[model samples]
Target chain A: MIDNIEIIGLIAGILTTSAFVPQVYKTWKSKSAESLSLTMYLVFFVGIVLWLIYGISINSLAMIFANAVTGFLALLLIFFKLRFK
Target chain B: MIDNIEIIGLIAGILTTSAFVPQVYKTWKSKSAESLSLTMYLVFFVGIVLWLIYGISINSLAMIFANAVTGFLALLLIFFKLRFK
Candidate 1:
């Protein structure tokens, strides 16, 4: 059975993972990414990929799911940053 | 002794945590946040705090350190998003 700490971690993962959606949606809708930092997204994407690898190495389902989605979303933001520029 | 998986997690945490630095620097230097989504930062800050709590609960030094720094950085972004707008 999952403990309270695990539940907290799960919620935290969900929040952090889904947090990128708004930025993506806003950028897509506005068709502007001027103020968005390309460096930040690039670094963030690489970091997310590393996190995904770490997740897989440990076989943690939450980490795997969170990093996978977050990484994809970060990629979209990166694309938006470039395309909208 | 730290294992390989733990080392990987540490690297991942460092990457993800420090990823926000460029963003904060860019936003502060530009004095503009037009393309930055306030909603995203707001949600992200809350999520980082939750992650910090989760990290503490799990007794993971990496998580605690990463989330604490990331949370502060996220907060700075949020402040920049508001102040620059």
Candidate 2:
């Protein structure tokens, strides 16, 4: 049986990953990223990449899935940041 | 003895948790969050809280520690978002 904590983690992962979707959508439609800090997001992207590697190393389904989607979103934000700036 | 996977998790956790600090600092100094999507962060905050709870339930020290710090940073961002806007 799957553990309860993992379930909770999955739910939390979904919520957090979905959180980025709106940011991507807004940035895409609004075509603005003036308030975003480039350094902050660049660091964040690196962090996400590390999480992805760690997740893969540990064979964590939740971690891998969450980081993959979140990483994609972070990339999108980065794209918006560069394009809009 | 601490296993390698957990070590990776710890390193990944620290990197991600610290990612928010720069964002908080930038937002604080800039006194603006216009480019940030409010809905995204609102959902993200709730997600972080869930991660904290899940971490506690699982007795995962790394998750608990990481989420606690990230949650604080997220709160600060939310505060800045509200105050600056």
Candidate 3:
């Protein structure tokens, strides 16, 4: 069974992972990413991927799930950054 | 002593946290935030704060350091989003 601390981590993961949704939606609707930093998203995507690998190494389901989803979302943002450019 | 796994985690934390620096620099120099979603930064800031608390609870130095710095950076992004509007 998961403990309270793990639960907090899970919630934190969820919040951070899902936080990208609105930005994705907004960017999609606007079809403009001028103000968005491609470098930031690129670096962030690499970081998320590293986080995913680290999560896998540690066997933390929470980290795996969060980093996986966030990595995907960050990838999409990168794509949008390029496509919208 | 830190293990390989912890080192990976530390590198991941460093990448993710420092990823925002370019964004902050870009936004600061550009002085425009039209394409930035305020909601994203707001939610991200909250998530980072939660992550910091979770880090503290778990006594993970990496998490604490990453989240603390990221939280501050995210907050600055939020402020820029508002002020540059």
Question: Could you estimate the TM-score for every candidate?
Answer: 0.92, 0.89, 0.95
Backbone collision tally, model 1: 0
Docking class of 2: medium
Q: Per-residue CA lDDT of candidate 3, range A1-85, in tens? A: 5788778778888999889999999999999989889889888888888888877886666678889999999999999989989
Whose DockQ is higher: candidate 2's or candidate 3's? 3
Best by DockQ: 3
Estimate every model's Cα lDDT from 0 to 1.
0.82, 0.80, 0.86
Clashing pairs in 1: none
Best by TM-score: 3
TM-score of chain B of 3: 0.94
Alpha carbon lDDT at B23, candidate 2: 77
Candidate 2 lDDT, A1-85, residue by residue in tens: 3577778778888988999898889889989987777776777778777777866775556667888999888888988899998
**Candidate 2 C-alpha lDDT tens digits along B1-85:** 3577667667767878877877777787888898778888889989989988976885656667878888888888878888899
Candidate 3 residue lDDT tens string, B44-71: 8888888888778866677788889999
| CAPRI quality level assigned to candidate 1 from its DockQ score | medium
Query: Which wins on lDDT, candidate 2 or candidate 3?
Result: 3
Candidate 1 Cα errors over 4 Å, as ranges:
none
Candidate 2, superposed: residue stretches over 4 Å from native: none
* Model 1 Cα lDDT, one tens digit per residue, A12-44: 788898788988899999999887878888878
Q: Poorest 10 consecutive residues of model 2 chain B by lDDT? A: B1-10
